[model samples]
Target: MKKQMKILDAQDKELMTVRKIEREGNALIIRGKIFGAMPMVAKLTPAEARAAFSLLDMKTILFLLSFLFRR
Candidate 1:
């Protein structure tokens, strides 16, 4: 049996079906297994991806920060 996962890109685009997901310290390693071939592994952090696509609005930014940091 295999596990299924969704792979998202930097632009919030659904890239492909994630074949596997692994953790290396604080980063996530994603491997795509589509088209019967092994795709390249992409390593990223939640904060890094969010920062890369962060919005400019101060209020929205604050809201997002609060949401992310909330326990």
Candidate 2:
């Protein structure tokens, strides 16, 4: 699976940049672009990436639960 995000400048310019963070086989792929040019990609460990996601999910779930239960 892959997740993507875009970075924008003050003028809301695309900045020719996109972040493609994905997992393929057993490796995590991190990609980025700058000024609509200069593409770069990197590989990361699954353990490292998933660890942050796990915490993020937990926080999201807690926030949702509290929101739903708020009076």
Candidate 3:
């Protein structure tokens, strides 16, 4: 299965994706892109990873964000 997931901007544009996920003990090393233009990396705890994946994809994530901003 592919862990890579696409990320889009606020304007509904393809920004990047979750290219890599590396697990080092209790930490998850994530790598992807920003604004679909540049590279990005982060280290998250098991709990943080759960929260991140709770939404599934960028489309849904962006939708929820937009909805929140509209209010």
Q: How badly does each model clash, as a count of residue pairs? A: 0, 1, 1
Order of quality (lDDT): 3, 1, 2
* Per-residue lDDT of model 3, residues 2-71, tens digit only: 6678877799788777889888789988899876668999889979868878857888877877885685
Model with the higher TM-score, candidate 2 or 3: 3
- Model 3 local distance difference test score: 0.81
Measured on C-alpha atoms, candidate 2 has an lDDT of 0.75
What TM-score number comes out for model 1? 0.46
Question: CA shift at 2, candidate 2, in angstroms?
Answer: 16
Task: State the weakest 10-residue window (summed lDDT) of model 2.
Answer: 13-22
The sequence of per-residue lDDT tens digits that candidate 2 reaches over residues 1-71 is: 44556678899987645567778889977788777688988777878768867777676868977886788
Q: Which candidate is the best by lDDT?
A: 3
Model 1 steric clash total: 0
Q: Candidate 1 residues 1-71, lDDT tens each? A: 78876657798666678877899898999888654465667889989878767755787767888895788
lDDT against the true structure, each candidate: 0.76, 0.75, 0.81
Clashing pairs in 3: 15-36
Off by over 4 Å in 3: 1-3, 47-71
